[model samples]
Target: MRLSIISTHKRIQKGDIGEFEKLFRNLYSPLCHYAFRFIKDMDSAEDIVQDLFYNYWKNREKLEITTSLKSYLYQAVRNKCIKTINHQQVKEKYNNVLRLQGQDYDDYSSSNIETEELNQIIESTIDELPDRCKEIFVLSRYEGMKYHEIAQRLSISVKTVEANMGKALKMFRLNLKGYYQISANQ
Candidate 1:
């Protein structure tokens, strides 16, 4: 089966799909388990693994294998899981802030409006950040990358990554001060 997979990988590189199903079947469950450790949800883990495989097949020609195929798949799943977890953390943090302040959850319309406004403000602040600052911030916060990893990916020093992240947080805090005040008042 491993030889067959190597052969299929070769054919896949040539834009063929003869052994695609066999390959998918072989990798799917293990990759899902790998993702579930990071994501902590069965469905999301499956989705992450499926997307990883889909992307692998889609970009098969450009795919380089310094490591084994299993390693590459696991890395992709890990990255996706980190992204999912970060997004969920942001959402949960926002919700908890509202709930803790004893906001009027009975007023569904108002609650939705406040949530939308907060999200909009966050989006706008992120958009207004300087180009490199925004990129570093997204990689670190949204993608859950370490400062070292972000520095390596951007080919900059870790100190630069830390400085940029500090700037991003400062900008966000300044920009959202009014919203924070409003939330506090509520």
Candidate 2:
């Protein structure tokens, strides 16, 4: 499965299936190992490598390799692993904050419990809101979407998003005020 550096580049550029298969066979395991160094999960590492190869193949005609193909593959896997880890971290942090704010736990009477409870109260309150207000609130708060982006996604005007969000907030304040004070004391 050996290919000269120049031949590999030319074969890939020419969309040669044989060379591509040879390249995949040669590179796949090593790239997965490289990804595992960062992510420490075999499945995720394999997925990242597979996606890298798929994208590589998909963009073969337009792809440029200033470095060796091996180097490019390694760099791509490294980047993908980093991105995956970062996204996971952001999600965990967001969940932690949400739980803390929502009163979602027990046993320790710690912030976690308060967050769990608060979360339930908030969800119920949001569910009780009018349909449009609930949608707008979820989009803005839970989805972390900007008002304008929400409007664009829902095919509404920004002003409508603003008005709905305002209504949602007022409803939340009225409904969750007692829960908020109780959680504050905990």
Scored by lDDT, the top model is 2
Give lDDT tens digits, candidate 1, residues 1-186: 353336666777787776667678888898888888897889999988888878888989987766666666677888889999999898777767768886534565587888899999989999999999999999988999999999999999999999999999999999899998998998
State the local distance difference test value for candidate 1.
0.84
Query: In angstroms, how far off is 42's CA in candidate 1?
Result: 0.8
- The whole-model lDDT of each prediction reads 0.84, 0.85
Clashes (candidate 1): 0
lDDT at 85, model 1: 95
> What TM-score does each of the candidates earn?
0.50, 0.54
Q: Give the CA lDDT, 0 to 100, for residue 19 in model 1.
A: 65
Instruction: Kindly report which residue pairs in candidate 1 clash with one another.
Output: none
- Residue-level lDDT for 78 in candidate 1: 89
- Candidate topping TM-score: 2
Model 1, TM vs. native? 0.50
Worst 10 residues of 2 by lDDT: 103-112
Count of clashing residue pairs in every prediction: 0, 13
